[model samples]
Target: MFLRPEDAGTVTSPTLIEAAPNEQPVLSGGVTLTGWRKDGSNRLGLPAAAQGQVWVADVPMVGGRALAFRQLWVNGRKAVRARTPNDDNLPRLLTWDVDKQEAWITATAVGTLRQAGQLEMVLHQMWAVNVLRVKTLTVQGAKVRVTFHEPESKVQFEHPWPRPIINGKNGSSAFYLTNAVELLDQPGEWHYDGQRGQVLYWPRPGETMSSAHVVAPVLETLVQVSGSLDQPVAYVQFKGLTFAYTTWLRPSEQGHVPLQAGMYLLDGYSLQQPGTPDKAGLENQAWIGRPPAGVELAGVHHTRFERCQFLHMASAALDYQSSTHNDAVVGCTFRDVAGNGIQLGKFSDEGTETHLPYNPKDEREICTNELLENNLLTDCANEDWGCVGIAAGFVRNTTIRHNEVSQVPYTGISVGWGWTKTANCMRDNRVTANYIHHYAQHTYDVAGIYTLSAQPGTTITENRVEEIGQAPYVHDPDHWFYLYLDEGSAGITVQDNWCPAEKFLANANGPGNVWKNNGPMVANAIKQAAGLEPAYRDLLAEQIKKPAANGAQVKQ
Candidate 1:
């Protein structure tokens, strides 16, 4: 029944407040807009021009519409500008143009949010905010709680590229390489150990195999299978992306799984070495393999590796030499390398380059092309050791951060930039938050970290280092010592880093070096040690041996 105009005022509610023209009306009482207050008594009718700016408390109630609390209103005067809280659960639903797939969100926030297969952030009116930071992403089952910057800005996750590859493989370098190139168009699935049935790589006469087409070989040693077969190779091409491989060991029962873009799970399998150490108790299989020439692992642009493990590599775990940008290797493990564990910036002898320098001068004098970040290593000492754990030659924009290195015979992480070229070649390379321990055993001048002649502006910060010894007289002068900064390496800031120094290291006693933050933990430990030097030393020594206690740790 249609109520008379006179009777409409009976349902008056005093708690409701009305807004003047050009103002957003705020409801006073708790009984606000729920499609229930249709009575004309307290209804704040709008002028014709601003009518759409406010939703009537109950215009739709006459029909079979349910009285719901959530309603979207657009500020018609503002041209559909949106605003809402940054809380994902409390997202204020704006006037969604469903047909056009356009949403108006107010402010912007930084941090990762899950959308289908990728992790990303949302921006709204990007010019409105200054620093766009998507600081964190917390995943709770299917519910992702995102915290953002502006309460008003809305963001959309529409674009999707190929996801960056994350964990894969275990202890087998052959399997690691194979998994790295799984998406490429190869003739057959990559295989290891030829006798088990599939094609494998072995040394043959003049095979002419490109890096893309080569297969895992079965060595003639019978114990370490290294042989090559006649198989078509594949050249893998890519653009901006990241691929992280770690934690795997080959087995007869379990098969090798390929690496893909995005976060992946790795399996912990066993690796069989050819023989045991002459001194150690275990007889492990030992057939360390070497990487073929020009084998590319990472590509150009914005990649990161966190908490990865590398094992049983006859060659480098990472063979990236291209002029890449914004790449990082973080929170990873490297062990048993026949070659370098994390190899950087490839080399070519086409012109008159000769053999690649152990650490190139031209590499570090450039921009940040590669970085080794927060990586850990153990049990990497080997009889046939070839290179450092993290080696960068002729590269730039490299940062080694919060890394915990141990048990490697060679240098832990190194930078040899500008050695081939000018003195000021590498710029803005930072080695920070690293805990390098127990190194320089097999190799000498083997610092916890070494930077051969790099350019100026290379900073080493907040590194807690221990157990690095001077190289024996017989080893190359380049191989021994802790914190080796040689060959015109200046503007180097060694600040706030801990090291077990027999004495202060002096390189030619030149003037330009900056040593700001240098100290030892023993002094601090002695304070807590309550005057017992032996007890304090023993306790501190034990803590340093454990991986969890030693490195620059990522706070949860």
Candidate 2:
């Protein structure tokens, strides 16, 4: 029998309270829960409930093994399991100070006010959520002097920029401005002032504060099956469960400027740092770092997550880390996630050292034999722009096939990690039969399918990618490509792919890679390779069409 919190009546409903005049309502009275907090800090103790509640259950173990209970249902709807205090709604910016990188916003009077140290700023951009830190917020007469802590080097100004547009056009540039607490200026907007210990909100036009059913996320993970190298968690199956509302706590060291899709580590380092030899062999080299995922799996084997739903998460839905072998995430739906949908392995080239060791003959270790198939990943990378839909770093013998990924901020599928062609453990990874499109909407130097390093047995086949937009940087065109083999990558095969893009393929010093039967003209060949009968051609055609709802777009 599937055990659930509701089955035993362990879940409690949040207590609702009336809103003060001109303020938002408050929801309280939920139990506290504990788990691993974000920011890689120490494991959190029993934390107090914020806008959401928590439930704890004790199940009798059999033979000293813990029971696996993995679902949280709330009021008949499957509640999402998130990190902490979800940021589903963001207040609009009232005014801007482009020079100081500050913004003006208002907060309604409601609930417990967040302190300065507890608050973080999130800028909703097209395809990305730029998470920032509030340096100083000084309330003036009507507005707050909100100063951001971003380094001057990270900000893109109008003149004398490294890459300038000769046409004097208004490219998508990072912008911000200051704040203060006053009467709710607009509907569906909220503001929090730590100095006054107040949270204010302006409800949507037809919405009432008293009738609002708020569900804030208080948990970081719904299910975790961890084992050590000596004893692995093998042969576990998690099927037909919906996991939601995992949160990403704001880091203490703020000023997290994203290069793309909230991938902050990719901000400073460049593949083309002046003195460094151009490793990728591209005229312009812009590379960044990778982050962790929400559903972390380490030192486990033969695990399967089938027909699961992962939504409203603060980070990547699934992450397979060290010693994770022969795992599969099949027929799942990952939507509205803050990071990537699936992350396999870790990025090899981290820290200041740019060079990586070459081990052409070393056998694959840590991660192998993974399969990700028939999943729908959409509206991901909501908070981090640098993340992709499916990211594989230093993994071998992995298969990512028959998935549909769209409306993303950066690349759709990213494989391999090392910048140079130096051989690592990444090999024999296959990306096939997926439909990817409407991505690269915010940042730059990306594609529908992007690969790095020299993975000898990598093959990309029969995928359909289209409508990749350009980066916000200057001197770049308004469109990207379907495939990118970057930075000394080699021995890969790109075959029978249907890419109706202005540029079908790109290579950055990648050698010994083969491209066969690709581009729009090869659509029929791609269909045939993917085993789609002629009768199913129309269904495939419809699947390639852009989705109706592409989530929020960056306001020009």
Candidate 3:
């Protein structure tokens, strides 16, 4: 909570903070971590096979630093960050060099892996993801090289395209090393140690560390709502809210590259002078950065967020962050967000240049008419596997309809940004009858309604988009699709979308695009009229933690 604005000027009136009718109100940014003194988990350095099953704590510092978060939340779920091929296996990546940003790992003793610069690898790269940070691991014969650190290791080896592909397509590219206190031997696993501010659990089953309930996330952006573009921040309204705990430590401070729906990648490169008047021999050059939002509006306008409930955030859960206009996120309910569950408008503003094309001479900086209807995005980009469940960049008339999005990992409704097929500032965007299902769950060249650049009266109609989740550590399991209009998808208008065959992916599209009557003979009344519209279908049984008396939704 930056705590400034106590009359620091500029708030041209018009604000109304709802929720008193059936009371929802939960806006927390977490910080409850009482004393918790258990100590000795092998003197708290934990490694002799988790030295008598880890459990130690003392962190708690708050305003004076050292609470060290990476997501904890004990009493109400989420707690397993000691990672290292734990459970979901995740290892392969036996050689890479992208000019020495290094990575070898076939694995072997490798000097018993201890802190090693607070370790954190998480590399899985097919369509973006590059955590890195290790900086030295050596053994190099039967493998285990690793390297990286500085400036995200030169922006993850000269950032070209969602990078880190070694062999390509379903092969050498899956990783996960994570915050190791020597991977704290199982039981719900944990570990934080920010150089001994300590905290190292291992409880699970009937946990009881003197009345359990931890909680760590200490604010990244709880509810900003600032104003500018000529004193905006107009008629604000936030009905029945819930937005909970937030924290996205900037990939533990400097080392997270991403360049797709999740947006990180502070500075990408590759452009030896690649054309781009409307994109032709265009050489990438990204800039992105915007993740951190548990409700963060900016230069707002007719603001509105009905039935709100973007839960447990660590990154992007409701962010109309730009000169937002006629805002409206109808029946909101983005679950367990880790990144992107509705991040409409402007995706290249860390200094612009994300392939240019974002024309704005003050059309109020352009995020016009936004309105995501019947929303209920579930699970949501769980720990940023390249986030997306409705991420709309450089928006104009945005109006995604009947939203239903499912468990999501990568791309389940992402719309235009400047990959450029010319024509800037986007146009009349509108993805209709949305239902997008299971989704790539882990990263692929994704698409269940994906798009990029040039949007002139955009229209992806009657979307039902089927299952599509088969993650076995993807690089490209048959690429993936069900409406992907990537790279300069111009003047869009894809018709009657259903999906179960006729796959769909129009990669370098441009010039008045249009594809009619999409897939499986498109019928069944357009796949039963897409999703969530019978007055929001009770938000498809909404839930981030809904349980008592059968509310359901805590399964993913």
Candidate 4:
């Protein structure tokens, strides 16, 4: 994340600007692309189907690079990245070798492409995705062998649990190749080739290059509220604003191997000795890095965001990075974010061991007393399968209430971290009265409400969860639940939640967890009052499209 020290930040009320009561302000982080030329008139070679339909533009160089970006926005909406086997016809993995970090596939499935190293293999596992960059592709007669670039190759093959699952619960895992010039056969798709220093696009219907407002994101963060533990930025409030069009560039530079909840692995490997001093069954060690956010906060106290819109961000929409307390994110709309909608507290530090419990000597290091209430989170985590609607890690005295979360790919809400049954600085968090549905769009081993680690006095109650979306490519169709408390989840009382059935999970739990009246038997009145108490129901009427099971967004 970039530190903008020159920006105005102070305790003085006038120094911080707030939008007028009736005005809607938008803070955007995008650059417009210009000078498009038809591929039929240019010398660039395209596929037969894309000859007259494609358009090319010279990529403006920035610091000796071809304008680093992962996504494009045409007419205020996202354009699909060029991928082979276009939408939903993913090929199944034949075999994967763990030792050599290689995968074999049917030869003819991937046509003879020119750029072998640029192809990215997106393999869907049980709970996450493994994005492997192809290093070499050797095609024999009937079978093709592909190798990956490191350290993603080590992290993809050697990581534990969700690593490259071949034969899963039902069928084998599926994958597809993307980011090659040969894959630009469909309209409304785009590709950026660094070798040629240009970008190519096949426009959608009714989109003309002369009038299309195409935006390419260059900055990772639009706004940042930063302070220190000693003197925090306090009593600042923002209202009626929109943050738009920011993209993260780390995944395109170094490989992205997610651990869980959109936290990528810096380095990870399974432990030979599966025991630690805190927990006896620990089997893995990992160091992780967090994705960027459009709006970030650190060492901020008593800050709030109200009636704001977060859109077109490549990573998380909003994040309280660390040492934030008594902050509230209320009545906000988060849409089209590639990562999590709301991320609070610390998952794991880049240099710290992931499984180890965190209890900083200074108590301010832990996030506390956060309020995430009455927000509308939709169409987020659409690309990152490891992310969720709301993710809170190592937070204390926080309350997540009366939110509506839909159209996400993984878990609706995930709380806590460390995955250990030991005590630390997390307790008394409340997740209550939220409506979560249409989740698990493309991945499984998830739930509407999930928890981890040993939170002392947490409670999850009166939430309504239903309609786990189907995706035929998931590893296990039956691996989902309405409410789940994973390893070391203790001192949590889950009661009075309404779901379709009695589908819940408590895997390798620790102690002192209580469950009561959480299924179909729950009272109708409790279910009625579960999500978005009367005033916030207008959020659903904004025409948010639901993601199809085939990984495409369609009108609901």
| Candidate closest to the true structure, highest TM-score | 4
Candidate 1 lDDT, tens digit per residue, 1-556? 1111121111232111122444322111011112221113221211232222222222222135322211111110001111112122222212334234333322222112232111112221100101112223345553333332221111111111111111211110110011111111222211111122112221123322232211111111111111111221112122211111111112111211111000011221112442222212222111111232112333234434443344333334555545355555554555544345666653322232211232344342232556665455554423223245666655555677655667665666777632222343355677776666776654343467666443457787666667764322212434355576754455567766666553335453223578764656434432232211232222223211111111111111
- What are the runs in model 1 whose C-alpha is more than 4 Å off? 1-295, 346-369, 381-383, 418-421, 469-479, 502-511, 517-556
Each candidate structure's count of clashing pairs: 73, 35, 1, 0
Task: Give a tens-digit lDDT track for model 2, residues 1-556.
Answer: 1222222211142111122444321111111122211212121221232111222222323247432211222221223222222332323445655556566555331112233343445454433345555666666545555555644224422111122122223333332221222212343433333333323333344543343333333345545556656566666666655565554544324444443433444333333334344343323233334454556677677777765666666667778867778888877777777788888875543353323533434243457899998788888875566678888877888998888888887889988765676656777889998888888766555788888788887899998888776544422454356888876678899988887643755556457799888887776756544422333333334322111121211111
Put down candidate 4 lDDT per residue, 339-437, tens digits, no spaces.
999999989789888888887899999999999999999999977887999999989999999999999999999999998888978899999999999
lDDT preference between candidates 1 and 2, better one: 2
Worst 10 residues of 4 by lDDT: 547-556
What is candidate 3's lDDT per residue for 97-189, written digit by digit as tens?
Answer: 877667787655333673476888888788767777787887756777878788888888887887766776567878888786777767888
* Distance from true location, Cα of 398 in model 4, Å: 0.6
RMSD (CA, Å), each prediction: 30.0, 13.5, 19.9, 4.8
Highest-lDDT candidate: 4
By descending TM-score, how would the candidates be arranged?
A: 4, 2, 1, 3
How does model 1 score by TM-score?
Answer: 0.39
User: What is model 3's C-alpha RMSD?
Assistant: 19.9
Model 1 deviation from native, Cα RMSD in Å: 30.0
Model 4's C-alpha root-mean-square deviation from the true structure amounts to 4.8
Q: What is the lDDT of candidate 4?
A: 0.84
